[model samples]
Target: MIHIEHVSKKYKKADNYSLSDLSLFIDEKEIFGLLGPNGAGKTTLISILCSLIKPTSGSFSIKGLTYKEHKNQLKQLIGIVPQEYALYPSLTAFENLKYFGSMYGLKGKSLDEKIHNSLDHLGLVKFAHKKIDTFSGGMKRRVNLIASILHNPKVLFLDEPTVGVDVQSKNVIIEFLQELNKNGTTIIYTSHHLNEAETFCTRVAIIDHGKLIVKGKPKELINNNPGAHNLEDVFISLTGKALRDHA
Candidate 1:
């Protein structure tokens, strides 16, 4: 289980906290989502959990592993799919996966097989030898995902995994995630795709202004809210339509 306790963050120049005493518990094998308007600190929370940054105060642990005590072990336990492409444009898809796998001490036949399998599953087998610089946005996104999961992590943290992909790519990505979840990989991801999250996520937390406003199963949240026909309705009702103008 992932335990977050009284987490908070305040940038040097920022007046308000990016996250205000946020606390959450994510269960094992659950597809947990953090839904929020821009500047809601979704990214900030994920970064803290991934150990990319330190929180101003508070603490968190995953499966009893704290970043402070088990940084290397924790890295092995979790896979991260950052918002930006972490690919080297000059390398071929296969070459890129090879580099990523080696980072975790994965090599030889098993590693090669894993790379091919992921490529085939993600419909990138034909493009395996293609340069990342020549791949489409969706293709690169798919490759980025494979890089994170090649070592088979216990938990996966994805930040906007499907931001600019086409419908076909999105479906493939979501299906792959579902398969990963079924195999006992706990997934915690952030997304703006309300419709996709509605069906894909088992439960979701809505955050805004660096605070959690609501959380529940999508169907339950929608059914309970009067006149809420879908997750988007509930999202808009709770988050409001105003632009989140911030630095």
Candidate 2:
């Protein structure tokens, strides 16, 4: 569970806030999607929640624990899979995962089993001993996911988890996440893929220019918006058809 109260973030010397009074609550075991255009503060909000950066104003708490008071506890409670690959190009998949597992205080047979099982589950068992530099984009993405969830985090924050992968990889990743959710892991995701969010998320919130524009179930949002046939239609209707290109 998560609670946010009037959370706002403004970087020093910046002309405007990246997040403005953004208050949101994510329930336990819920798959929540944070949808937004380029530079729409989705990443900023997630970074704040992950404690990668402090909010300029207001605050948030995860599972009744604030980062200010429970940084260590929260670290144990959450996992993050960033848009970029977090693997070491020079390290073998198994070695890289072992290193990550150790960061969470895991070791020996238990950690080894966890790593092998995850690699097998993600279709990377054969590549476990291969250097990350030798992996394809999809393989690297799967490895990235394995690294984050090695500790079996209660909440998982994923930014564009399936952005560049082929359809097979994307399907596997989504199915893996769905299984995690079924077993009670809360997921907070951000993506430009509205179709995936429509079926994957229990609830979604669309924001733009650092403000919440709409929040609801995908079906509810589509039905409420007259003439909308799908989540993409509803998204375009609210966020518009303009390109969100940013440097």
Candidate 3:
């Protein structure tokens, strides 16, 4: 469903590429995980795929449509839940969602129903009228996710959708995502939660220094790496124990 070819990116005056000729594919309905430590180019690659940033070289296509030739179509084809909350603090949850849905050309009673259903599913219906600034981190995260799927996108790109939530909220989010996947949404997400990815993802790619170091089923990767017992073990073995700090 998604194809990336020799994609590369370099920020202005950067010492190294954020993504270097990286290539991969994600099948329809697959939950693909991009796992790496900080500064490993995961977000850069997602940003490129989401068309939030342009690649310095190479290209990619989603569902046989390139952003260059099919910008509007591609915009309708995917949803994005960024790592940071993309909500209006002053707006009520319902109000914020209505604004977001309208961006995708959604309106009327159907849009209202969609928002309410999503809020109920994510356990935030009670707070629908509350200002975003008053919601807890978990509530805002849930609202953020609801905003992305109002139009029912074919592909969902989530960057750390469960970053700061409590265990209950995380479980709810994961369950909600699993439901979406079951209904045919292809999911590609980047997360530092190795354990979650191990069980949640159909396959995963481990990247470092702007390159794909390994890609496979979590069990396959774990079994293939000698002495590795889990995805975290495989990750540490492949990416190493050193810090990836960058300015």
- TM-score leaderboard ranking: 3, 2, 1
TM-score of 1: 0.98
Clashing pairs in 3: none
Off-target runs (Cα >4 Å) in candidate 2 are: none
lDDT of 1 by residue, 1-247 (tens): 8999999999999989999999899999999999999899999999999999999999999999999999999889999999999999999999999999999999999999999999999999999999999999999999999999999999999999999999999999999999999999999989999998999999999999888899999999999899999999999999999998776
Off by over 4 Å in 3: none
RMSD of 2: 0.7
- Give the per-residue lDDT digits (tens) of candidate 2, residues 1-247: 9998998999898898989998888999999999999999999999999999999899899999999999999989999999999988999999999999999999999999999999999999999999999999999999999999999999999999999999999999999999999999999999999899999999999999898899989999999999999999999999998999976
Clash pairs, candidate 1, are none
Question: Which ten-residue region of model 2 has the weakest summed lDDT?
Answer: 238-247
lDDT of 3 by residue, 6-113 (tens): 999999999899999999999999999999999999999999999999999999999999989999999899999999999999999999999999999999999999
Give the backbone clash total of model 3.
0
Better of 1 and 2 by TM-score: 2
**What is the RMSD, in Å, between candidate 1 and the native fold over all Cα?**
0.9
Instruction: Work out the TM-score per prediction.
Output: 0.98, 0.99, 0.99
